[model samples]
Target: MPLHKIIHINETTTAYFWYITEDVTSLFRAVSLKDTSLFRLEGMKSEEHQRGFLAVRMLLQHLGYTDYDLSYDEAGKPHLSDGKHISISHSHEFSCICISNKLMGIDLEKLKEKTLKIAPRFMEVKHLENLTTSEQIEKATVIWGVKESIFKIKNEKGISFPEHIFEDEFDLKDGKCTAKLHFNNQIENFQIHFYNVEAYIFVCAFPNK
Candidate 1:
């Protein structure tokens, strides 16, 4: 598929999802990559990762960009030549990219039982109470995505998920939530939007401006 969906998150932010039904060779031939990206793609250990990487470029092309316009900083945060903020995430057979005029972060996570099993390690287990096992898995996956999105927004060192990011309680049906990042002697507030796509949870975080 070309693009699974496009979410106009705000006046200046958008999220693009790519359903990776095509094989790696098909994706490789569809997008033009710079030498460095080609090198990185060649070194990738898994076909899935290569497909994810190439799918992102396909997304860029859709947005009027090419591989030459993307770069990374010392902290491995992706940037654009035109100075917009970008965040990329892919899992399993789906890849996603978010672009915004403001500082933002996005995360895509597959719903799985493992996220629920390890919920206590990163989130407060009390929130999982009163929910069925399946609900628990879905909620835990969203919470993990919340933390991950915030982490990408900050992209600072020593920001532990459990210790630094705290997700406020919200109903699973709400499909939205708030979170706080208590790090670097400051507190930051974030607004979160999440949705379920197939077996995956897509999350987007925008810091309070």
Candidate 2:
């Protein structure tokens, strides 16, 4: 699939997803990559990762941009040339980018048992109580996505998932939630929206205003 889906998060933000079914050669030929990108792609160790990298560029081209329009800062956060905020993530076969006029973060994660098994390390395991096995996996994945999305937004050094980020209690039926980031002796709130995309969970977070 090309652009698999577009979620209009709000008037100012949109998320684009690309389903990666193309081989590395085909994807490489489709998009024009700047020299730096080409070098980075050549250095990748696996074809799966290479395809994901190229799929991100494909999404950019679909949006009337190119690799030249994308750059990253010292903190490894992506920036758009036209001054919009952009966040990118890829897992397994899906590549996605979220663009917003305001600062925000997006994360895509393939649901797996490992995330649920290690949930204790990053979140309050009490929140996972009383759910069926499947529901526990789904909810745990969403909470993990919430934390990852928020981390991408802050991108500050010394932030630990378990120590600084907390997802408020939320039900899977709600499709949204809130989180708190405790760092530097200050508390910051965030609004989160999440969805089930194929076998993956897509999460977006914005700093609470």
Candidate 3:
């Protein structure tokens, strides 16, 4: 059975929600799974990952993209066979893909309480000080999303949060924020866009020039 529920966020972005109603085996088959052993995930993690990939593949097919092939560069960032810019993200419940004629990145994270605990590791002193209210936790999560998006756009791993980037303190009244990139004085000026998706937040960045 095809994925009946489709939510089109925009012309360039689409999201699909899977309820996990089907068995794991069926889900894999729907995704045209072959040699599942390559993923090396087991149990619940395996199921979740497969489902996410299936949704992504279906979305790509819907977009008229055939001959879908993915390869990773030396930095481990996924590349496409057709040379199109693509970004893939998956949270606990949904998988998201952002494709555009220009370079882009997409991310979806489940809103959770643990964000507070991990805030320090990802946020800088200025970012924390900018919160200055009971809504610090929510603010931190948005910043984290910005960092994650930038990380994906750069396609480089091992990027330190807070120390490597910064986001302006802004109200959520507009449901979005602009962030600045600080990468060792080499690439110090760039902006990112942030938006909220229900309980989750999403950030996307591109070259400011």
Backbone clash numbers for all candidates listed: 0, 0, 0
TM per candidate = 0.97, 0.98, 0.76
- The 0-to-1 C-alpha lDDT of every candidate, in the order given, reads 0.93, 0.94, 0.62
| Candidate order, TM-score descending | 2, 1, 3
Instruction: Report lDDT (Cα) of residue 54, candidate 2.
Output: 97
Residues 1-209, candidate 1: write the lDDT tens digits.
78889888889998999999999989888999999899999999998899899999999998899999999998999999999999999999889999999988999999999899899999999889999999999999999999999999899999999999999999989989999999989999999999888899999999997
| Candidate of highest TM-score | 2
User: What's the lDDT for candidate 2?
Assistant: 0.94
On lDDT, the leading prediction is 2
- lDDT, residue 64, candidate 2: 95
Better of 1 and 2 by TM-score: 2
lDDT for each residue of candidate 3 in 145-199, tens digit (9 for 90 to 100) = 7778777877555567667777666775555566666665565444555566666
